[model samples]
Target: MKCISWNVNGIRAVLKKDFVEILYALDADIFCIQETKAQPDQIEVDCELYPYQYINSAQKKGYSGTMIFCKEEPLSIRYGMNMEEHDTEGRVITLEYPEYYVVTVYTPNSGDGLKRLDYRMEWDKAFSAYLKSLDKPVMACGDFNVANEEIDIKNPKTNHKNAGFTDEERNSFKENLLAYFVDTYRSLYPEKVEYSWWSYRFKAREKNAGWRIDYWLVSPELKDKIVDAKILTDIYGSDHCPVQLDIEV
Candidate 1:
């Protein structure tokens, strides 16, 4: 199956761009989106290919949210981590199939000056535990909001203390998620340099100054099934481009 994950930044905004066109072009079996910034009622995707569409909107309007579009109906669907504090943001959505569970997450950003760093740390622990509790193998994807290693981000020296590149967040990601799951792209191509996200300022995308924050991570047992993982940098319409995963599952 082919699965694609992208942080659209805002669903409504991307819809005005190439969202629908890209959806048709990629033709993924499952398409996961993050940072929807819209309510369930507000999202109007015109694609007829995906009859099963699920959205997890935040309590606050036009805020962090996630959505998934699948051609086949899942056996079950779950929203959030079942933790009230974290669920309010509509950051997580899990779809359980017969073979495996597919989870899409919009991890909280630490915020300017790292004001929410403490809460982010707490979220990491809870999110990790939630994934571990799943009964079947998992294929989790989305904008994790953290660049795992120096190689994952451009100019690591200048971004050391930044929100997504901070040492604390990196360490937490390693201990929390990487310990249990395999990062598909990095696992397949350790030395490959590619990025999924780029700053909107200073022509960062044009200069190729970007960070590989978005990912497709799977359970260790599913690691060998990973056929191909890619960062579709050529695609546009959002600050973060789409990441694709091809697997037999």
Candidate 2:
């Protein structure tokens, strides 16, 4: 199956920028998006290509949210981490298939000056624990918000202490992998230095100064099933590009 995950930044905005055109070009079996910033009722998406749709929008209007469009109907769908503190943000959505689970998340950013670092750490631990508790093969993808290693981000030396590259956040990511998941992209291309999200300032995308903050992490057991992992840097609707995973389901 071909699964693609992207942080569209804002669904309503992307719709005006040939989002549907890009969607048709990719033709993925499942399309997962983060940072939707709109409730389903508030917007209209002609996602007729995909019969099944699931959305989790934040309680606050025009905020963090996630949506999943799939050709395959899942056996069940779940929202959030089953924790009130985490669920309120509408950051997570899980779809259970007969073979595995597909989860999309919009992980909270640490914010400028690392203001929310503490909360981010708490979220990482809780979210990772929740994934582990699934006890089934999982494909978790979204804007993870943390660059796992130096190679995953440009200007790593200067950005080490930055929100997304902080030591605390990186370690939380590592700890999660140590438990039950594998960063599918890194597993396939350990030395690659590509990125998924780029800053909109200073011509970052033009200069190719970006960070591979988005990811497709699969349970260890699904590692061998991975056929390809990719970062679609060419597609442009949002500052964040899409990441894809092709696995034998």
Candidate 3:
């Protein structure tokens, strides 16, 4: 199966770009999008090709949101972890299939000056627990908001204390992986320098000054079925590019 994840930044905005064209070009079996920033009624997404569509939009208008579209209908779909604090942001969605569960998340970003770092830490712990409690093997994807390792960021030295690169955020990501998930991209290309996200400022994308913050993490057992995990940097509509995963499932 071909599964792809992209943080479109804003669904309505990307729709004005080549979002639909890219969707047709990729022709993925499943597509997960984050930072939609709109409710279903607010945007007209003509993804009739993908019969199954699930959306989790934040209560706040034009804020964080996510959605998943799959050609194959799932057995069940869940909007959030059933936790009040986290559900309000419309950050997570889980679809259960016969073989495995597909989850897409839009992790909260620690605000400027790391103002929300403490809350972000709490969120990490809760999110991990939620994933661990899943009944089946999982294929999780989206913008996790953390650059994980030094190699993930363009200038680790300068970004050490930043919201997404703080030591605390990185360690939380590590703990999540240690729990049972595998970073598919790193597993396939250990030393690859490709990135999924870039700053909109200072021509970061042109300079290739980006961070591999978006990911497709799967249960350790599914690692063997992963044929390819790649960052599709060439495609553009948002500041973030898409990440693709080819698996036997």
Q: Pick the candidate with the highest lDDT.
A: 1
lDDT of 3 by residue, 1-249 (tens): 999999999999999998888888999999999999998898677866687788999999999999998999999999999999889989999999998999999999998999999999999899899999998999999999999888898999999888899999999889865457999999988888888899999999999999999999999989999999989999999999999999998
- lDDT ranking, best first: 1, 2, 3
lDDT of 1 by residue, 1-249 (tens): 999999999999999998999999999999999999999889999898799999999999999999999999999999998888889999999999999999999999999999999999999999999999999999999999999999999899999989999999999999999999999999999999999999999999999999999999999999889999999999999999999999998
What TM-score do all the candidates reach, one by one? Answer: 0.99, 0.98, 0.98
Candidate 2 pairs with clashing backbones: none
- Report the C-alpha lDDT of model 2 over 212-245, residue by residue, as the tens digit: 9999999888999999999999999999999999
Worst 10 residues of 2 by lDDT: 172-181
Whole-model Cα lDDT of every candidate shown, in order: 0.96, 0.92, 0.92
Scored against the true structure, residue 36 in model 3 reaches a CA lDDT of: 96
Number of clashes found in candidate 2: 0
